[model samples]
Each structure stands twice: as C-alpha cells, then as structure tokens.
Target: MAEITDDQINTALARGEAVRLAEPRAASVRYDRQLDRVIVDLTNGCTFAFPPRLAQGLEMATADELAQVQMLGTGSGLHWKALDVDLSVPGLLAGLLGTASQMARRAGRITSSAKAAAARANGTKGGRPRRSA
Candidate 1:
C-alpha cells in the first residue's frame, strides 16, 4: 500500500474545492409529486428541478419511491434509502445523470438536445442539398 502524505491530502482537498466544492451545496432535495420532479435548493440561493425518469437508476422508480429522497453529507449528495441509490449534487448540476458510460450513451441518443438543435438548424437552411447526377 502507498503511504499517505499530508501534502497529498491537502492537494486533493484543494482540487476538490476548485471542482465540485466551488459550487454551493444543496440545502435540500424533495420529490414534488404534482410536477413529477425532484427539486433541489442550493446554499447559493438557486433551485433546480429534474424529472426522475431522466435519471439513469431512477427511471423505473415510483413517485412514492422517489419521495424517499434524503440529503447526504451536508447536502453533497441525494440518497434513496429504499432503492439504495445515491447521486451527487455537483455531478447532477454538471449534467452527469449516471455512470460515465451511461452518460455517454445518453449523449449519443437521437433525442439528445444537441442533435435536435442541429436538426432544427438544418431545417432552417433547407435541409440536405440535392445530389448531382
């Protein structure tokens, strides 16, 4: 095993702060059944909401199950005890809805916002040009 050093720990903490910790932590998270979304309030006075179905593991969760949302580690994470699912506030804010590969798959899907935007832009330009015979 590699011996740990104080310098290494300090460096890691500094890096962590610059990345995720730089943003205000989530002050609260709740499932709003009426809207079918999870709402999160941040320490920086911002509120964010997303549908449970948009999340990877949360796709099949019932509204009652999603209502089990709980704040983890001083608002750094949202956890569902019954489902054994945990997600990071910063990661969610950064658009990371799942593990790396899952997010990549989402990014590549035909329904992705980027692809839709591209299609819309192409339509405005009269779409594909005619092929020369």
Candidate 2:
C-alpha cells in the first residue's frame, strides 16, 4: 500500500475525515515529546513515529503538556484528554501534525489478558498461586 503522505493527511483534516493509518491490529500508542514525535507501537512489534505537527487543526497543548499526555484510540483515531487533541491515525502517518505515538502499551495489555485467559484454561489463575486440592 502507498504510504500516506503529509499532503493527503492535511487534506483529510481539511475535509474533516477520520483516517486509519496503523495496521488494523495496532495495540498501543505513545508520544515522545522530547523528540517531538509520536511512536506507533504495534502488537507485532512494528513501530512508526511521526511528528506532532501533523495534527493540523486539532488543538494541542504546549510541549510541556504534551509530555504528560496519555492517548487512547479506537485504531482509527486518537484522543488526548490532557491536551484536548483528537486525530485520526491515517492523518498522522500521512504527515499532518498535532498527533503522534501509538505505542505497544495498549497492545501489551491485550496480550496480558490473553495470557491470563490461557492460564485460566489450564486451571491456573494468572499471576496468582494455585490452591492445592
């Protein structure tokens, strides 16, 4: 697939469209403001980083505030309550500014849940000692 370009992303924001940029199963997103970039960490271990300016019209907090941001996404878009910013992933990967970092943190949480489920199937509670019969 063609990589989403900055211009295309900008157009989407201009047209008010939500873009899905990451792989469908992307698990988490983390922003690294010191580097002025957002990192998209996937469950499969692939990562993509983009500049924060790509979120054109979205309201973003100051850099210091961005450093404290916690992001949540539906894999289609991102929301940062602390920054009052919301952006679509495709717009991000395409190069628009104001949004970044979809790290593996969320994905890791899902993986942990799956592991717990498997352990339960084996009659063992995850992260806890099993009781003797």
Model 1, 93-115: lDDT tens digits are 98888898887887677487887
lDDT of 2 at 23: 43
State in Å the error of residue 79, model 2.
Answer: 1.4
Query: TM-score for all predictions?
Result: 0.68, 0.42
Which numbered prediction scores highest in lDDT against the true structure? 1
Candidate 1, run of 10 with poorest lDDT = 16-25
lDDT of each: 0.88, 0.59
Question: How displaced is residue 81 in candidate 1, in Å?
Answer: 1.2
Clashing pairs for predicted structure model 1, backbone only: none
**Residue ranges of candidate 1 with Cα displaced over 4 Å:** 1-21, 112-133
Candidate 2 weakest lDDT stretch, 10 residues: 98-107
Global Cα lDDT for candidate 1 = 0.88
* Candidate 2 per-residue C-alpha lDDT over 16-117 given as tens digits, one digit per residue, 9 for 90 to 100: 542343243246777686788767765557677766653443234566655554545446566667656666655565655532343333345455777977
